[model samples]
Target: MENKVATIYKNQLQEYTQKVGKRLPIYQSFNEDSENFPKHRAKVLVDGVEYISKMTHSTKKQTEQKVAKITCESIFHEESEVESFPFLYEDPTLRKSILNEFVIKKKMKPTYNMISQEKGQSPIFIFHFAFGGKTYIGEEAGNKKLAEHLAARTAIKLLLETNADTLSPIIMSKVNSDDYFPKCSGNLQGESSSRHKRNANTNNERRNKKRRFGN
Candidate 1:
């Protein structure tokens, strides 16, 4: 009698599951005869903070051979905004040109005053260049934090203007040209002069090597 009652309950559950999704994240299905039985379960995939929950369920032996295709429809919140994520870093030139134009074209408001080297103050409008294999990453920085942040915003604007279809999460090289250019009121001395000389030497060597091996 107990087994018969269990069977009837199981059948009803299976029918309900088939009619409506399990509602709960997890659910089970079982096919019990006088001896052995078949059992199965299901789960739902989650993404970000988008939807609250999903429904799923199981079937009986009559339809056990049939596969139920899983499908999902996105649900949006009242105040939420959804946009497709762009494919960033797909092209290096697109990234470089976007940054370059931003720096050259726009004039950012001054964030700080030019300070003396003795005070060891950094300069406004520092250029950063990250070396990428065939391309380069470039950014601008001002002495003030606000100015630096402005540079990034300006760059992003210019990029959008040029390529309306560009993807999000912009990609570029990791070189910083700002470090190479510092703000000092007077003559180059000590490490400053040494760095200049080294840069000049490196440029000369590259030129000489290129001449030695013609394109």
Candidate 2:
């Protein structure tokens, strides 16, 4: 039973996804089974991030609304614009360049391919990379290039979250060259400048080390 409130939030989520160019919110009847009588607890996964409702509802559709409502609340706060998501606000194509900079700075090569998914639907693009001696799967679009960009965006988000603390040093070492980075503006540019200024001597030492070792 979808009520007016539920429908409005769901609609908002749909519009937000479209605006952000992400896949539509996918609602599941139950991500974790419930022992309650209604037995309808829902979850939604968008942009590889999952949101599960805390409470169960009477019907599957209601449960779906619960997840959708929560997802909407999380993404679309007081400000409802693409700019709200700074990291993801860039064009999908630019994200590829950023992802490349991150991976290449670590001297790791990413392997990309496609895998069979739904029988009638398009194949799923898959990206792979290795770090700390462990292989990780990382994507799909119409063609390889497009798929790579899409995959890059996904990988960047996941990796940035996964490597939040350690990744900064990996990035800081490459500050000697501007060629390795994509165009940045606003908060990214500001924070980058602050970091660069803070680590000026470190950057110089790393550059000198690279030169001496021919790395």
Candidate 3:
């Protein structure tokens, strides 16, 4: 029937869009400097904290590898004048996928996965800071952990990289545990569920009414 075909098409479209969305951030990560993946938007992990950094994109092979090649030698080499740090690709597509997964898909609760769920693996770094006296929390993920961590080493890094600077220092600097803080509050979740159920029931009733009228 036409209704069955329309439902199949909608499902297929949703799946296809999600699949493509997931690949955008990953591809943008590799093709650093493209407008699709701006550096300022990329997340950098330092110590045990994740910070946004000033994304300086490098097109050369040396620069691409620079981010992945961080070592103790480069980080603290006796000859170093300035701190040697690696570059990160800020893939916008990946970010959009994440937003969609949390905001639109609403399948997974929006939380930064500090460890691999499948393997119980922890990320490479963990750094703590303070806003006055309270603890500030941050963390890192993925293979570029070392390089990313080094970049997130200072308050300056945080200030320069994210919109955090725009927030009141009191709230922005409240260093809390990296817990799941959904943009939508937990109390509203039940209300949202109820609304969705009501909408679904309404739609089904309408469909049934249409069928009955046609018969």
Q: Which candidate should be chosen as best, given TM-score against the real structure? A: 2
Deviating ranges (above 4 Å) for candidate 2: 31-36, 78-215
Candidate 1 segments exceeding 4 Å error = 1-98, 101-143, 158-162, 165-215
**Better model by TM-score: candidate 2 vs candidate 3:** 2
Clashing pairs in 2: 125-139
lDDT (C-alpha) at residue 93 in model 1: 22
Per-residue CA lDDT of model 2 for 84-150, tens digit only, reads 3332313443454455556555666545445435435665555544444544453544455555455
Structure candidate 1, residue pairs in collision = 22-56, 86-167, 127-177, 127-178, 128-176, 128-177, 129-175, 129-177, 130-175
Alpha-carbon TM-score of each model against the true structure = 0.22, 0.34, 0.21
Please provide, for model 1 over 1-215, each residue's C-alpha lDDT reduced to its tens digit, 9 standing for 90 to 100.
22222233234334434545554222223433322443333332223221211222234422221111121222211311111111121122233333433333343221222222222365545322221111221243444343333433434444454543431322212111222223322111234446768899999999999999984
Quantify all predictions' global Cα lDDT against the true fold.
0.32, 0.58, 0.32
In model 3, the worst 10-residue window by lDDT is 84-93
> What 10-residue stretch in candidate 2 is worst by lDDT?
80-89
TM-score of 2: 0.34
lDDT of 3: 0.32
Better of 2 and 3 by lDDT: 2
Per-residue lDDT tens digits of candidate 3, residues 1-215? Answer: 22222233233323333654532111012344565654323332333333322334444332222232232223234532222111111221122222222222323322222222232564454433333223323444444443223223333234323423332232222212132232322221344556778999999999999999995
What candidate 3 gets wrong by more than 4 Å, as runs, is 1-188
Model 3 scores a TM of 0.21
